[model samples]
Target: MRLTYSARKRLGATSAGVVLTVIALVMLAPMAWMAFVSTKPDADIFSRTPLSAPEELTGGHYANLFDQFHFGTSITNSLVIAGATVVISLLLGGPAAYGFARYPWRGSGVALAFLIVARMVTPAALVVPMYTIMQNLGLLNSVTGVIVGVSVLNLPFVIWILKPFFEQVPKEVEEAAELDGLTPGWVFFRIVLPLALPGIMTAVLYSFLAGWTDLIFPMTFITDANVMPLTSSLLQMQTGYRIYWGELMAGGIVLTLPPVVLCFALQKYLLRGLRTGY
Candidate 1:
């Protein structure tokens, strides 16, 4: 049987949809299990049915997570570090990305290369140096130390992600703003920034996730239980409570939520920013 062009197109789309559905299911299974197991009893959690949906759901684990584990504090600390990283990263990296995108310099290529080089360097390589530096400055086991250290890890990623978006902005609009007697700084703040807000926010979201999920720097730099971020705090969770599986899943679910919300909220902007800059 011969297929019409319309029939073939429909077939192609159906095949693609099926492929996407499979991929999505593969990605979603673990999260589904995590959410499911969160409602399970401690005994059910360790059984072969780790991914089984609970017959009788309970909020006990979530309550234990908040009350016994003091998850709120670690969450607060995580937010502070991620929040600070987002602001400082945007403040510093945005201008640099814009500069690299807009301003043509003989050395601009070299500088961009250097920034990329920073990304290629392993965080593990710097652990010793960072630890030594923190010790000398007396920042060991400090929140400020974690922020600064994570920023170093995040800045290069921000620069690479944001530079393309910045470059996508039209130079003519900037020139038109200049024609209207708008200073470069004024144009950047009023026009360019507003246009780039989507890319910028998405950049922040990505950078924040990088910092939020990072365990190495936090583990290496912070020793005190009180100052630890949530990722680092996860280590202590299993130690005291005799491994409360439900509570662990609850925290994992909570941990998964923020960046997802952030990405969705800024999605329009991120898409526009990518199109504009790309």
Candidate 2:
């Protein structure tokens, strides 16, 4: 059958839309199941048709999470740690990135390479040394320790991401600002930063997520229930004999919500940052 050009284009677009819709549903299926299991009673969760609509909805799992598991404390801890990680990563990494972008010095390439290598080093390998250092410094079981560890882990990536954005800023602008008697720091704070705001926000979002979702650092460094973050608290739900699937599912939803919400909220800035930085 011969079709008009516009008709063929419309058919192609419709096919593409259908494929994308199916892919989206596939990706979201697990998250939907998690939410479903969270709201279902234990019997429904264990039913032969697990994905079927619940016969009775309940908030018992969520209630148990707060009342029995003390997930409220963990959520608070994750918030504090992630917030601190973002601030510290920006404070330290932002300038480091700017320096790498603007000022080339002796061994600058080597230094940048080393930073990339540091980022590649597995977190698992560093866990023992980090635990030892934190223990020696009396920072174990402290939010400060977790914040510092997470910030260090995220710093290299933050610097790497921001450097490209900084490089995109025209040097002539900085030179013009300098000729007007503005110092380098002033130029960076007033001029360069505004231009690079999108990239900086991207770094902040990623660094925050790193700290928020980390299980290894919190599990290794913290023994106190008072300081456990959401990731570590979720682990406590599992034991040798059995697992609390319902409460765990509810906790997983709670743990997942903030980052999901943040990504949606900052989708514009994040997309812009990626486009600009690359």
Candidate 3:
């Protein structure tokens, strides 16, 4: 017997729910294991079943992160780098994207295409040249070097992400603002930008992640323990022979939390921006 439309809809919904639930479990399983291992004693990490509760738990690994490894320094450095990257990307990308959307001069599409292509290139491929450039500019072994490197790499992506959102803004709104005697600059700052907040938030999150999680530039350009970000610092947990699994897991948790928290806080804007920008 053929199912009614309502019955078919219910069946479809059930299937989607089941699929999504399974996918969520699959994705979350590794994170759960890492968190579990992080809290367990060194001896207990591999002893019982991987997911089983530990006989004892300790916060020593977390303590070691601060006491022995000075993980706090890494956290501070990463925040500075990420914050600077976000500011630079938005200040530069926001206006460029607006220009691209509103004023399509000759060869503008070609220029935008080049920007997207640049973003797609592997960071690994650019490392040698980037390193040489930073060294030439006396930015090596400093947080500023890493910040500059990350900003260069992330700028193209920010432009690409923000362009669509600017395009989505109604030209009519800008014209209306002009009729009310608002200058172009004031119209963008007061009217158009507010409407594009969702896109701006999305761009902010991406720019922040690019800086926070970048390892290549930091590792290549910075050697000072004080200047290293969390991504590069996490590698200190490994030596030639043995890995400090417990402390590594703890550090991983620390590194992961900021981005996750930011995403949760900005989830509404992210969803709205993605929906409307496309």
Give each model's whole-structure lDDT.
0.81, 0.90, 0.87
11-117 in candidate 3: lDDT tens per residue?
Answer: 99999999999999999887787788889998888675666677778999999999977899999999999999999989989988988888899999999889878
The number of clashing residue pairs in each candidate reads 1, 0, 0
Which of candidates 1 and 3 is the stronger one according to lDDT? Answer: 3
The CA lDDT at 77 in model 2 is: 97
List TM-scores for all candidates, in order.
Answer: 0.88, 0.94, 0.91
**Model 1 agreement with the true structure over 75-134: per-residue lDDT tens digits:** 888998888988888888888888888886998999888887887778889888989999
lDDT string for model 2 (85-198, tens) is 999999999999999999989999999999988888888898889998988999998998888878888899898889988998999999999999999999999999999888
Per-residue error at 180 for model 2, in Å? 1.9
Q: Where does model 3 exceed 4 Å of error? A: 1-12, 179-181, 271-278
TM-score, ranked from best to worst: 2, 3, 1
Candidate 2 stretches greater than 4 Å from native: 272-278
